[model samples]
Target chain A: MDPKVVNDWRLRGQRYRLEGELCDHCGEAIFPPRDICPKCHEPAKTPQTLSGRGEVYTFSTIYSAPEGFEAYTPYTVALVKLEEGPIVTAQLTDVPPAEVQIGMPVEMVTRRLRTHGEEGTIVYGYKFRPASFWHASTQA
Target chain B: MSSQHLMQPERAVGIIGYGSYIPMYRLSSTEVARVWSGGGRGPIKEKAVAGLDEDTVTIAMEAARNAVARAEIQADALRAIWVGSESPPYAVKPASTLVAEALGATPYLLAADFEFACKAGSEALQAALGLVGSRMGDYAMAIGADTAQGRPGDDLEYTASSGGSAFVVGPADLAVATLLGSLSYATDTPDFWRRAYQHYPRHGGRFTGEPAYFHHTQSAASRLMEELGMDPDDFEFAIFHQPNVKFPSRAARRLGFTAEQIDTGLLSNLIGNTYAGASLTGLSAVLDVAKPGDRILLVSFGSGAGSDAFVWEVTERITSRQDKAPRVTDYIRRRTEIDYALYVRYRGKLKT
Candidate 1:
């Protein structure tokens, strides 16, 4: 299914996603937000933004689907283990169903999900891809 | 008389009011089993189906309205509204709040939900009594309703009935029935569960019988007898959560309760398993014929966990206000019948 029109509403003004963690005791960057500061019990934690990039932990080919995505009936939906620790489930976009493999690099891409048939708001969410970051160390 | 010392002058929070809602519709099991599959000695002959707009929320609200009317208390008097059902309309939103609104309960009234599979409603009642016994409020409302649906060809399709019942829990003088004793136990084993969301809860065929239903029910009931100093012959009416009409009867035999001992439970064969409301609805039926000082022993089982055993003493308040709540048999007889096609339509099993 084409995500361009569907994701248009959710990503209307922002094409980028803020996907990292903001800390409590001392402002810090932590991937997959740490349960504790490993220091204090302040319990005050704010979200931090990071580049949405990860490796595929597992994937599945959805041979059966409900209506709308008749064209993408056999699409792949997978869990990409974010470097920040959160394992996010998303549609494996920009890739063929046959090519998916564990440990493949993926990055966040905003896309639309279902349709209301007319001018209804479309659902939006993250998708992954093979890494091509300008910096090599970004692999971490 | 010895137990009277244990009984305090505490206000008995009873159903100042009670109301029930069974969709004005019915479907014979024979029709459902015949239409879904050629012939399977299954959910064999009937069930209740709700209209598309009726889900758990509406059914619960309609019953709440009837109960509030019987109690004659404004919706505003409700200090807490708790709904127990496996089929909450939404995964995120609270159905209790919606019920509170329609019934005019105070907005801040504690609104919550509980799901212990089939036992959820009775469990809610136990908790509500504890809350009321502590003077949490003069009363609280607990409702159980379900339109439990099974997969197209699944056996559960037949007995998953739709209905709701509300009990107002409060103290002694205003109490219709007082909770005398309770016994319960929990064990985590899957005799039934619905992993695929597409179907109603599934059980391991009759695995629910030996392991889940009988074991838990016997455990709880025995505990009740021991705790309340009551014997099987001492009760006038006993209600058990009915998975099917045969279950309660079989369990009664195992517990040494005679066929006539559990005669009140004979009602489920006609209306099917109302899930959360199953046993309570049965209790409602028993109350229809019970007299003051009559003792009722009840037990409820919810798979993935436990059973609750409770004994209630029907007081003069129950009979004086018997006319207040609709008679159980009357409500059972006052249903609207539907054919297999409309049954599917009401069940949302048909395509738009």
Candidate 2:
């Protein structure tokens, strides 16, 4: 069995659906969910699913990618502020780096993050795309 | 074997909602020809290309979410989720499981992956109808998605593309389009196939026509119409599995359907062949503009060789749900063109 599989499995909720902890006492949203809340030091045991709709708080374009991501050089990564009040750092897709703007509305989409190797598991996670991409004209 | 009559579910079943997903990037056939053949156009104008981070799994998930949104039903209410794809991301893993998980329809859901070349999506659609009609499940989702590949410089490269559609089948009363009947025709013709451990598929060229696509598509459509006591004139729209622009048009004309009948549903000329997604995406496009009481005829052909023919009638629910999610034509219009180098990189045609 691959060790990476266990780690990926543990993070499926956050990776697959943007599931995070909602603080019951403080009524605040927490992402990459820690069991305890940072705001009030309360137990944030309740699970909440984010709307996956957000605006780009900030971004950077990586012309030189790190190991394992050389194929995706010139990709843009962004800090997205979710509608539910949580900030997430994720890769942006479908739009060119030059087109990326701060405060741009984006939506979450499931996409391949990386693969371990030729025979290893292919890891999939959430990425953001321009919301306008989904609102094309009905007339073809 | 040919059925004496069209198959009906134990109870009335229909599509509660439907949705389609086409990737944002496109690769022009002209670019493909420029690289290899020294500049001449290929069959279609351009083809949708999935990004490096996109695959059958992601495409299926997006389509499923749109379907659930249009159905106006809770994802947990869906009892079954089936995905049909020729180019699933993993050879060993099931794409359906991941889709089910992403939709929050896990544990209690009956999920599985299916393959039958291009007809695979309709295969799942038939099973969904049966599941809902039998009263075993109130709602079931059938998805046909693919990130199809062709060997570098092969004729198939010009047309192979990525896209998919999903349908939620439920009781007729809640349906946007009701399924009237269905029929299937199959044979061991081996017109196209990929052997084990092979990355790309091979075809029998001209043999894929006449004996495989035409024979099975015509046989199934003719037989279904015959058994249902209907004619091409009875349908407002028609959809056929589109490998390219020519085949489906020729098949439609030969089957007595007027060009106008298939005009709205003919999308291959714009987006290329999406394999298992071919016919289902066409259906989604027709449903986008179909009026209530309109009838639709759909026939899908797979290369291993088989065809699934279905008859559908739109209902008032279609009008309200058509705008709940992005329409098929919307995806068609949202495009970003890339040169051959970027296309090859995105599709992983060139190994690292």
lDDT tens string, model 2, B26-79? Answer: 999999999889999999999999988899999999999999999999888999
- Per-residue C-alpha lDDT of model 1 across residues B181-247, encoded as one tens digit per residue: 7767789969888774444566788787888888998888876787667788888778888878788
Candidate 1: regions farther than 4 A off: A1-140, B1-13, B40-45, B196-199
Which runs of model 2 end up more than 4 angstroms from their true locations? A136-140, B1-3
lDDT of 2 by residue, A8-80 (tens): 9889889998989899999999997999998999899899989899999999999988877777878999999
Chain B TM, every candidate? 0.92, 0.98
Question: Predicted chain A of model 2: TM-score relative to the true chain A?
Answer: 0.94
The TM-scores, one per candidate, come to: 0.68, 0.97
Candidate 1: DockQ? 0.01
CA displacement after TM-score superposition, residue A24 of candidate 1 (Å) = 57
lDDT minimum window of 10 residues, candidate 2 chain A: A131-140
